[model samples]
Structures are given as C-alpha cells and as structure tokens.
Target: MRTRRTRAATAGIGAAALAAAASGAVLPATSAAEPARQQPPPGCETDCEKVFDLSLPYDVRFTGWRDDSAPGGRSVLAYYIGDELHDSRELPDRGVQDAECGWDGDAQRCAVTYYTGAHSTGALSALLTADRGIEETDSVRGGAPGATLRQLDGNGRPDVALRQSTYDPNYADAPRYWETYLEFEGKFVRTGCGAPEQQPSPAPTEPLYGSCAYY
Candidate 1:
C-alpha cells in the first residue's frame, strides 16, 4: 500500500465525499481503520519528494494470489521497467516469502519465489537464477524486514534491483525511505520511495514549521 511500483513516472486526488474516492488518499470505512503500515517522519519531505517527482509519469500494476485458500495470506510484487522484468520481490513480514535476482544482457531480471518457512531470526535465504547463474543469499531480515539486494550501473544509476532499508539502522520503523530509479526502454522511472502516501487525516491550517504532511 505504501508504494506500488512507480506508475507513469508520476501520480493525486480530492478531499471529502469519501464514498467516491479512488486516489490512494481515499479508502473504504472498514479500510479506514487500517492505518498505513508505516510512514516517513517529519522533515523527510524533501528527500521523499525527490523519489516521488522522479517516479512521476510511470505506470504501475498489481497482482496477488493466495498460497492457500485458508485464513492468513501472502503476496508477491513484480516490478517492470517499461514492460521488461525490472525486479520481482516478495513481502517477508506478511508470510516469509523469498526473492532472487540476476542479469540478462544489459538488463536485469528478478524472480520472487514463495513457500512456507520458519521465522528464523528476522532473516531468510533463497536461490537466485539468472544470466549470472545460480546463487543464494539472505533475502530478508529483521531490522529492515523486506529489504532486497541491488546493483547499480556505471553512471551510478539503478540498473539492477533497488533495496529499501530503514533510514536509521537502529529503528526498524524510522521516518526515511530510499529507492533506485532507472531508464527502461526510453523513459526513466523511479522504483521506490520511503513514505509515498498522504494520510487522509485533516491537514493543518496554521502551517506550523514542524507539521508532518508525508505518508
């Protein structure tokens, strides 16, 4: 819910009239109770906006399937760079999923594998298959939760996967976000951000210097 792959490299909505809401800001009554899983802290808007403005004008798609038909659930996220396989990573805290990455030609592709596993110690490992051949590494951990592994190009651009980690290593839920953006096909798209949502709560009228407006 935080960020669903940068769509169209850009992405807003209205206030009031809760029933007719479609923007990320609006949510059903039942969902309203579900506070955002996380968000950025005060004074992070500048950094957060850097990623948001970079990701503007991109397109995003989402898909999820149940590993089983029972009660709890798990999900997978596949991020595409202009229709090519940009990266595919799974949610860990949700249900202990695994992900792996590799390269093909000048492009990189990722495969997010899912299976039942133990909680272990805030981390888990998985096998990766790609042009680079097979390798295994810790795909998830405790402090950072679903942090992924990433690589960059000669220009210091995100050519491979983009890993998201806590802004502060000491706090798993700190107010900071980071991501990598790359040019796929023709246009450049940002792949991630720290806190991208604008909570539906009322905005401050006095405009205090320390007020928080980020997700």
Candidate 2:
C-alpha cells in the first residue's frame, strides 16, 4: 500500500546476480606453488554499512555499494546466526524496490522487491528456521510487480499479497487493479473462505512453482 524507493546501489544488481548464477562460473583457487595472494587495502565498504550486528543472536540485513564498472553496483543481503556469517548472496533485483526483515515467532522472515519494466517484480522472500531449516519462496507472480508479505501464523508462516494491472495495456494509465493473498506452506493455499473466483486479470502464463494458486 505504501512505497519506499530501493537504494540506488541495488539498481540492476539483481539482474546481474541472475546472469552470474546462470553462467555457472567459478573462480579458481590459488595454486600451492605460488606465493600467498596479497590482499587489497580494504576501505569501510562493508563494515561502514554494518553488514551484520555481532551483538544480536540473528539478523538479516541489506547492504549496498557502488561499482561504476559494474552494470550498476551491488545489492547484497547477509544472514547471520550470532556473529557467524550463516550465508550471504547478491540480490539481483536491479534496484531496492522495498525490503523487510525480522524474526517472526522463532523463524526469520526476510523479503525484497525491485522494478521490472512498468510492473514491479517481487523478487524473493525467505524463511530461516531452526536446525538450519531455510525456505526460499519466489513468486510465480511473474511478469507483473507489486507484492506484500505478512506472517499470519504466530509460528512464522507467511501470507503474500500480489497485485497486477488487469486492464488494457495499450494505454499509459495504470491497469485495472486486481489482487489476491496467497499463504505459503509447501506451496501457497487460499487463506480466504471457499474456492474463490479468479478475477479477469492478466495472470502469469508461466507455471507457478511451489503450492501456488495464482488463478
């Protein structure tokens, strides 16, 4: 319902991550015969941004940095368990459309968004649970943008709200508005009453992964 612009560093970063991931590229390890590689004199890049808070038991925070040589810089999220770097990865959404992160019940809930043409692309949402039970759920809500997520269950299960223009696309005016909230377990299930009617909207033709009901 409300919007906040994603930080500039995120611009096109998501797409870059996608490209890198798709390419299946890897850097080679240094050879034993060669002398130890010299490390560059680092600045306050990641530290100044506070990638992680060591005092906290857990945190999922977003950080950004500029790289002119890069298509548009970098947008990354770091996941921490205590002070250890549980995991970190590049967010290739191209821009920081919006993001939310915090512990829900006993699990960690994190999400972020970015722009894709005229429509908004809800990139990803992740649930980091105990015993290293991490679930990454993405939208089959493709080809469109504008998505919101909420944790309905006190135990941290998620409910997502996705909206897209269903009206004529030829005009500049925003498309006719239609929205639905899908709950996630193994896949999304209708959280509302009964088998609801699917509105006349331009739903994604591509198959939805997980238990998704985008009709």
Candidate 3:
C-alpha cells in the first residue's frame, strides 16, 4: 500500500488533467496542425537527450483526479536518487508493450516510464531509486524532447508505455556528475497492465485502488 500524500506547488496545474495528458489523449491547447513529435523506443541507446526541470522535490500528492472513476488518482513527482543503468522501481512486465529508460546526473536519479502524457495533468510519476545504492553511469545519447516509446503486449496489444531522457552532465558545459537534465517524452500504455505480470480482473487499477506495484 502507498503512504499519505504530500502537496507541493512547484507547477500550477491539476493532477487529474495531467494524468489524462499522460495517457496521450490530446487536450484543447494543442492543435492537430502542430507537427507531432517523435518518441523514444524501449530500452537504452546512446541517442536520447531531452531534459526539463519541474523544479520540485521527490514526493507524491493528490492534486487532482480523485473522483471515484479514478480512485487513488494523484500526480506523482520524484527526483531520481539512485545509480545509473537501472531504476529499482523500473521492473519488467509481461504486459508492458513498450518501455523507455533515462538517467539524470543533476538529479542523481534514474527515471523509467511505461508511458507519457502532455502537460503533466494526469501523468503517473515513478521515482527511480534503487534498493541497493546508486548504479554506475555509462555513455550518453544526444536526445530530443517530446519523444515517446509505444509498447505492444503479448497478445499484440499495447500495454505499458512511458517518456524518457538520457543524462548529459556537461549539457550546459557543466562538469561531469554536475550537469543534469531530463530528456525524451511521455508514453501511453494499455489500461490492463499494472506493474506486475498479472492484474486484478476488473482492470483499471484506480477503481480497485491499484498501483503499479503488485505482490
């Protein structure tokens, strides 16, 4: 079970709406004419480097999306506090159709996502912390912003998805281990696949107070 909520006003926006955007459903603000941005693919490669600073600490809070339709709905935000290579929370899932991973040296954390959304209204935020200390760092890929990775499940269906970025400590001519930025874009995964391989029958974890973490 998750713990209590923590409220932070780093960004002024509703959480529910952010989650919706994370799901890839377009909002009123963006126009269809706007050229769609290319997304990243699953796994790590040297070619990803988009970064944005939410200017907030790592914590969970219930900003919006708290209605019965999406119970346990809240905006998740976190600062990567683990080592390189892998995020402890970024577990593999059979249901995950696609996945993308990134590491931020500035934040000193790793971020892995199953999907993405626009403007962070209803986006699900997962922290990239390791059970062990931090992981080792490796070569980086020059990345672009707003790139997404789409995943297809076992039944040839879309399951997990996410946005990602590669770390470049020297991005702004900063020193190694001193430079940090977020790269990549958001993702939209199928509804059924939670964190674990199997999920509850009724689908949509929120209604059942579900989370990505499954026993």
Candidate 4:
C-alpha cells in the first residue's frame, strides 16, 4: 500500500468533495482475497479501549475512546493497520462525536462522522470501511449524537449510520442519514443514518450517545 500522511478533512465537506481537494488518503481497490465474515474478538464491550487484533490477511488494530476533559466530545477512534501515527481532534462545539469500530466477520468495521463545529476546522468526511472501504459521504451536522457502530438494517453484517446536514439537493437544512452495510461479496448499500424529527436525545435520563428506541 502506498502510504501518505494522516490528515483530517476540513470538517464540513463530502468525501469526494474534500478528498479531491484535501490531503487525507484513500485506499485503492484491492485484488487480495476477501477475508471471511467473522465476529469481533471476544471481551469487546461498548467504546472499548483495548487493541482489537484482527489477525487476518491484513494486520490491523481498532481502538476507541473519548477524551477525559469533556468526556465524549473529543473522541478518538483509529485503526493502525500495521504501523502509523496521528493526532487528537477538537471537540465539536455542539455536534460531532467519537469514532466507533468492531468486526463484521474477518473485516474491521469502523465509522467517523463530521460536522461544522467551533473546534472542527478539519475535514467534513464520513468514512466506513472494513473488508471493503465504504466511505460514501458519512458527514453530518448535529455531532456525536448521530454517528454509531451498531446494527441498523435487520441483517448480520455490521452496519454504520451517519447523519449529514445536507444529502438531497432538493432541500436545505435537511438532516440526511445513511446506513452502510458490509456484507457478502462486499455487497454494500446505502440507507438513512437515522433519527426522529424532534429534539435529539430520547430523554434527559438516557446517556447522550445511549441506544434509544427513537434512533
């Protein structure tokens, strides 16, 4: 793999828009054999901190964590496929959130959402990839409450949903969400990131990023 510096996008642009103009890198199509669908290694709880050793065709490690100062604001989720180094991003003033990762079989499934934040001058790119890279405009506006690594579609494949501020050209201020499924034959599809039209958060009692029926 031809490597480049790890650069963040300018926090409010689409993947194609920013990647075409910015410095971050994207992996090219691979002819390598597809790894089998395998579950995440045991002992992984939500927002896990340990290195998830993939132990597969490609050596990879998935790490997830939220910064201590503001809790889940400055969240850091990263993948070190072999040997790489990078930095900590700012917390979104209101929107944006931490990164999430897991296993969708032999692939490492991970997600990252973007928004226009007081602290986010980086890029506005959404990335979802594991067996095959699924980054197709994963950006959003309302921040951390919108991105998640969980089952959205009723399937066994790992899915990620991210809400972008603008998805359809027909409307403005439209909160568009998309769910990307990583499945057999790398059969990937798009769906809404998910949420009701009301105020964010199911109730004051639940955690900000907690799993609510409304989402």
lDDT for each residue of candidate 2 in 63-130, tens digit (9 for 90 to 100): 32222234543344444333233444444434434444443343444554444445554445655443
- Local distance difference test scores for all models: 0.28, 0.38, 0.23, 0.33
The backbone clash count of each candidate, in order, is 15, 13, 41, 20
Please report the candidate that would top TM-score against the real structure: 2
Identify the runs in model 2 with alpha carbons over 4 angstroms from their true place: 1-74, 101-106, 129-135, 142-145, 151-157, 167-171, 190-215
Model 3, 1-215: lDDT tens digits are: 12221223234233443554455543211111211332222221222222222222222110111111222221222122111112211212211111223222212222222222221111222322223222323212112122132223322111222212222333332211111122222223323222322111222312111242211
- What's the C-alpha lDDT at position 48 in model 2? 24
- Which ranges of candidate 3 are over 4 A from the true structure? 1-42, 53-83, 88-121, 132-215
Question: Which lDDT tens digits does candidate 4 get at residues 1-215?
Answer: 11123434223323333443244232221222223432222222244332222221234333333333443343333333334322222223322333343333333344444334442212233233332233324333332334444444433333444433333333343444333333223333443234434234321211124222322
> Model 4: which ten-residue window has the lowest total lDDT?
202-211
The residue ranges of model 1 lying beyond 4 angstroms of the native Cα positions read 1-100, 103-135, 139-151, 154-215
Best lDDT among the predictions, by candidate number:
2
Measured with C-alpha atoms, the lDDT of residue 179 in candidate 2 is: 40
Task: Please give each candidate's TM-score.
Answer: 0.21, 0.46, 0.17, 0.32
Candidates 1 and 3, the one with greater lDDT: 1
